[model samples]
Target: MLTNTVTMTTVEIAELTGKAHKNVLADARKVIEMIGGLKSQPSSLGYSEATYTNKQNKEHPMLVLDKHLTFTLITGYDTGLRHNVVGRWIELEQVANPAFAAQAITETLNELQARVNAMAPAYDEHVRKGRTVGYSWREACRLADIDHPDKLLAVLVSLGRARKTTQGHTQLHPDYERDGFIKTLKPSNLVVSKNGGHLFKITSKGLTEWLKAKAEEMNTAVAFAGVDRWGRPIK
Candidate 1:
C-alpha cells in the first residue's frame, strides 16, 4: 500500500513494523540527534511533530517523516520489515513524482485516443447512413456533437420541420416522414413534471439532413469570410 511521505507518522511506522510507538519515537529522535549533533533538530530528517487521535479519542504528539527520512528510519529495522517498508517507500516516490504522473496520464490518453481512432470509421458510417428510428433531442444533439440543442430545436420549429404544443409536446418534421423514418409513441410510464417538456424523437434521416444543413451553413460562412475550412486566409 502507498503512503504519503509528509503524513507518515511515527504511530503509523510503529504499526507497520509492529513496534511500540514510544520505541519508534525514540528511534526517530536518535536519528534526528545523530544528523544535527547533540541538539535535537527533527527537521534534519524531515521529521515534524503532529497530533494524532488514538482509539480512545485522545490526541497525542506524533512524529511525521518525509520520504528521505522515512527510508533512513526504516533501514534500521530487520531484513523482512526493511524490505516491506522499502517497497512501500518506492511506491510513494513514484506517486509523488510530477513527471511520472504526467507521463502516466499522457500514456492513458494516447491509449484511449488510439481506441477511438480505430472505431472512428465504423462510427462515422453509422452516423452518416444508419437508421435511428427514435432518438430524443438530447440524444440527437449528442450524436451530432451539437452544443446548443435549443438553437437547433428553435430552427427546426421555425422551418416547419418540427412542431411544439403549448403543453410542450413536440411533433416530428414532415421531411422525416417523406424519408421513411418512423417515430416511437410517447412513453406513458414517465412522470411529467410541471416544468418538463416532451422531447420528440427524430429519425436518422432528420439527423443526417440537419448535419448537412449545418455543414453547408458553416461552408457558406467560411466562403463569405474569405477563409478556408481550416480558417486560413484564402490566397
Candidate 2:
C-alpha cells in the first residue's frame, strides 16, 4: 500500500526544503540509491558531535540525526515492525517550522505511492496447479512469513512462483534486494513494461498458475497488489 509518488530531484528537495545542499545530501545518502525522487532535511539537528567533512562528499556529521532520519524512513515502510513511534517524531518534525519538514509524513506517504508505482507488479507462477502467475512477491513474503532470502525462494518455488535456482547463473538467483518485486523471465511468466523502458511483465499463463498455487497455501487473504484476471492491479 505504501508508495513513493512525488519524487523531487536532490537539488529540488534542497531548495524546497530550505536546507543546505550538503545537509540534504548527508540526510538522504542511503535512500538515494533506493529511489528516484529524493528529499533533503529542512534543517540541521544541531548535534554537537555532528561534524561536516569538507571532502568532496561532504557527508552529514550528526550520527543522531542521521540515525533518526534513516530509521524514520525505514520504519515507515517496514510492515513487520511492531512500534509506530515514527508517527510521533514525524509529528514533531511538522512543528519545527521548516519548508518540507512540515510535510514530512505526507511526503513520505506520497513517496510510498511512487515506490509502489515503481514496483509495478508482474505475474509469476504461484506453485499451484492450473494457475499461472497472480501474486506479487511483497504479498507472498508477508503472507508466508518468509522474508529471508533462502526462505523466500523456498516459498516461491513451493508455490511455483519460480523455478529451481540455477547455481551457475547469478541473476537467476540473486541475493535478496529489499526494494520492490522479484523479477522473472520465464516465457510462461507475466510481462510488464512502462512507456519507454525495458520489458518488465510476465505471461498470463504464469499469473493463473501462480495464483492457483498461492490460493492453495493462502486462500483467504487478498493481495494488496490487487491484480486481477486481466493481469493489472486496480489503479
Candidate 3:
C-alpha cells in the first residue's frame, strides 16, 4: 500500500500534550477565529471535521489538523510540550515523505517490531512456568495514585470491572468485555501460581483508564459539593 500523510485530531493533540480534549478544542476554535479575521485567508491552514471512536466504541465529532494548524495549536502550550510536539511533527514529516524516507522508516519499524516479537516467547515462558508477569496490584495503585487499593478493588469487583480467580484473587477484567474499564491484561499474559496465587497485570491502557476515572471522580466531587444527588442544596 502506498503511504500517505497522517493527520491528527484535537483529541490526539490533547493526548500527546496531556491537555484536556475540551481545552484543545477551545484553543483550536480560538485559532480559527483569529485566522478568520486575517485578510489573506489561509483556508488550508485550519481544522477540519473528523470522527474519533473513543474507548466506549462510540464515534464522536472532532477537529482534525494538518501540519500547519498542528504547529499553530502547539505554540500555545508550555515549552516542554512545545518541544515534544515539534519532535513529533518531525516524525510525522519523515513518514509523510516515505518516498525519500522509506529505508529509514522500514529499518526503524522492523527493529521495533523485532524487539516486541522477541519478548513474546519470554512472556509465554513465564505463563507456562506459572509466573504471573506484569504490573502487580501495588504498582497499579501507585500508577493510579490511589492510596486505597482495598477500597478500589472492592469497587472494581462490585462494578464488574475486575475479575476473581478460582483462588479468590482479584484480576483486571479482560478487554474482551466491551464494558470493561481496562483492557491491558490478556488471559495468555496472566498466570496463577501456587505460591503467589492469582496475579493481575496492569497495563498502560489500564493506567490511563485509572487516571481518567480518578480525574472524573475529582470533577464529580467538585461539581457536587454542597449539593445532593437530587440537585437540592445541602442547607
Best by TM-score: 3
Provide the TM-score for each candidate, comma-separated: 0.37, 0.21, 0.38
- Candidate 1: stretches off by over 4 Å: 1-7, 37-41, 98-235
- Poorest stretch of ten by lDDT in candidate 2: 193-202
User: What lDDT tens digits, residue by residue, belong to model 2 across residues 41-157?
Assistant: 433431113444445876544333333344433332323220232333344444543444545677765564454334322111222211344334434433333334344444445
Instruction: State residue 127's C-alpha deviation in candidate 3, in Å.
Output: 55
lDDT of 1 at 164: 84
| Clash number for each model | 0, 37, 0
Best by lDDT: 1
Q: How far is candidate 3 from the true structure (C-alpha RMSD, Å)?
A: 15.1
What TM-score should be assigned to candidate 3? 0.38
Q: Please, what are the lDDT tens digits per residue for candidate 1 over residues 1-235? A: 2343434678878877889998998887656543442335656648778888989999888888876666666655655565555445444556665444646555644553454445546544554444543455566556555555665556567667678877667665656666655354453525223213544455665554554335446334434455567888778
Q: Over the stretch 19-81, how does candidate 3's per-residue lDDT look in tens digits?
A: 888888877865654444122544456557778888999987778887667766665565566
Give the alpha-carbon lDDT of every model: 0.58, 0.36, 0.57
Ranking by lDDT: 1, 3, 2
**Given candidate 3, what's the lDDT at residue 27?**
78
Backbone clash pairs in model 1 (N, Cα, C under 3 Å; residues 3+ apart or in different chains), count: 0
